[model samples]
Target: MKKLLHFLFHSEVPDINERYRKVTSAFVVIFIIGYSIGFLQLLHLGPYLGPGLGDNVSFQPLITSLQALHSQNPSLWYALIALLCVTVSFRLLVMLAGYFLFEREEGSAYPIKWIIVFFLCNLFSTLTIPLLLFALATLFWVSGLDFNLGWQWIDHNVRLANQLVVNHVPTLINAPAPIAVLMIAIISGFFHYWFHRLGHTQRILWLLFHRPHHMTPALMQSTTMAVFTALPLFFFIILPYNLIFGACTKLFSSEPLYTEVIIFNCLILIPEIFGHHTALYQIASRNQLIRLASFISGGGVYHYMHHSSEPEHCGRSGAVNLVNIGGGPLFIWDIVFGTYCPLSAKTPRAGLSGQPELHMNPIRLTLAGLAQICNELYRNPSWREKWRIVIGSSSYTPTLSTDFAIKSNKIRQEQATPNPATIKNFTFSAPADAIASVAAKPVTGPQS
Candidate 1:
């Protein structure tokens, strides 16, 4: 027990930052092609959904009406693309100063096939998220809990107290450009921090939505995979933000809120894109603003620590990796909650260390987390244990050892057994290139 506890929280210093070799021309070519495809899709080649709400209660039409925002009503294409471009470009720019992408994968296009699916899923999530949230809004509306109604009642006459707070604190709707952007960052980041933490803390949530992301060993090609969530988790993550956004539309009756929203959605997500890359690369910068921003936002070294699942990085219970949990324009919440792990010399490995299936196949990996939960449910026959499995901390062990899950995963692995029956049984066949997505695939590409 003492050894187990020590293994869980043993924090030894890690190697200093690694410098990756120059990327091959093929990787550059792949990125160019990918970006071109996205640009074309943005320009109407992509499928567009009709506005979700007929009455425009969610400001659905106003967002879809904007050409820059994409065809889907209130789509996040603008923000999504901005994040991709900025993240990749920022690292590329930092290339003039330091290496970020893995040096071993320079000559490889092997991961592209696996990486593209997540990229496309991210696109899918952004476009469909608004529509999904309004469906949730409709559900909440039926429950006598319309956030807009409550907000409207409070803002009915724009009372003196409300006005003072609006003027002083920058309400989501009425604030000027600079203040409004800051407010959006805080609000959106606040939601992201909690939701992200929730996804980690709860076993059900970790399996259902977060596991697919954590399965990727490399963060470089897969950073955009963040938020590749299913419909249920999609509603969970965006509902509160949408509710607040809807209520804010009521705040400014005269000025157009859509324009500000376009700006808000696009600009406020800088911190969201900022942190994950830090998972793999220790960005070197003496620029005080950049340094300070990373420090406050938990973006640079701090957030990189969040990805570490090594026993050395885990907490005393060995159940959670509680380092640098803040993901925001400010990680002040993490500081307040005592979950912040400052970026130090420890270079933690990303991904599950000893998992059977690292979830290389996007098709299988997407729901694999839920499958693990279900396995746990099956292993624990007792109803009380089952209930605890869903709601309990993710690190909570079941009555049965997870060796069953490990063996089941191994049996299902394409390489392990080459099981066609397994492949055909899944909703989608595992793609051929999944094998190449593994970290062991060499830089010259796969030996196979």
Candidate 2:
């Protein structure tokens, strides 16, 4: 038991690099192509296509909601935008202040290239894809295609659950609004924990989606939103989670849950901002209250540790730690499931270990990442190993092992150099006459 406890809290120091390479030409080429196509499709093509392709049957609720918000107060839209900007700016400022004041000396320097890359990635993922999807979904709807695409399974479940709670569960309905909100929060947290954990454990999911987030060589304030994931992940995981939460809110409360949602969003943002600030200094003389909070909620430090690149800190599959410390605002689920790594644990390296220095172009990086995922899906032997664990054919054991890291480093080194036989085959050959002519011409010297 003592040995197990020690292993759980163990931390490894991370590697630091002062100089980062510039973005590659390939990355820039891909980025420009992707950005141009996305811009044209979203701006010029979308409006033209929308009217011709589809009717607004499915989007009526969304239209009605927008109309209601506008009718309630036109200025509310501007106010909401202002609030979003203020919150984001405030969190950024806080992270920068913390870094400069406390962690400047020890922390990795923030690279401007990475900052630019982060913003571009976020813009592409958050804005471009949604607009593109909207246009495409509209076209599909007009063509008599089912836009929901079997999401009714999830919707049906949510509706049934909400109905059961409202009709059969009298005690739940009578519960105070705060209590109901808390219950919803806990349920949301639980779902988020499992979703995050599965993303790490599942090989295909991690490669295609979660790997991009872990590709950053260093962490900064902007890192919180630096996720690069496929569009389907949002629809399948994020959208469903929100739908369930919304259903719960409607079933549990007589009043609108807008204020409650706003509060929860604000609370959640605090930890998220701090969690990505990898350089937040930790004091030795820890406050008892703060320690308790970290233990319960897997605070900023806990998450920072989650970004560690150490093999021992990772799980059996070697992609991420089995003791994954991800949770929503409160990390109650992690604590309950024994996945919570506390502040006392030593911090490990951030980013993917043994990964070559990556090009800073977001679009190219995203494409390359997807390619790598595809290669791993077909070629990596670890898939079978992970499957063994999944099938209960092998007993699960968690230990600090460097075997994977060592092999990864070796593979990276091998990839960096070409084979001698291949190099020999490509050796340039010159005709004797050409060599003689070139030798004869190169004998000229300076007149001076």
Tens digit of per-residue lDDT, candidate 1, span 269-376: 333333444323443222344445555444554455566555344332232345556544446555545455434344456655333434233333444555556777
In order, candidate lDDTs are: 0.43, 0.44
Which runs in model 2 stand beyond 4 Å of their true positions? 1-90, 98-103, 130-135, 138-174, 224-232, 248-251, 281-298, 311-319, 328-330, 353-356, 373-448
Q: Candidate 2's residue-wise lDDT over 1-448, tens digit each? A: 9986444323222332434323432343344344322322222111101111111224343334445666787886556445545645555555555434433635434554565666566666667455655665677678888765332433443454545444543333645756655665565556567666655655445544565676665665454344434533544453444344444454455444443343334434444444555555242103343333333343544566566665443222242343434654345665465454334233355666444465555554454434543444445457554353233211121121111222233333102111333223321223332223222322122110
Candidate 2, residue 286: lDDT:
34
Which residue pairs clash in candidate 2?
314-321, 315-320, 315-321
Question: What C-alpha lDDT, on a 0 to 100 scale, does residue 279 get in candidate 2?
Answer: 54
Listed in order, each prediction's TM-score against the native is 0.54, 0.55
After superposing all C-alphas onto the true structure, candidate 2 shows an RMSD in angstroms of 21.2
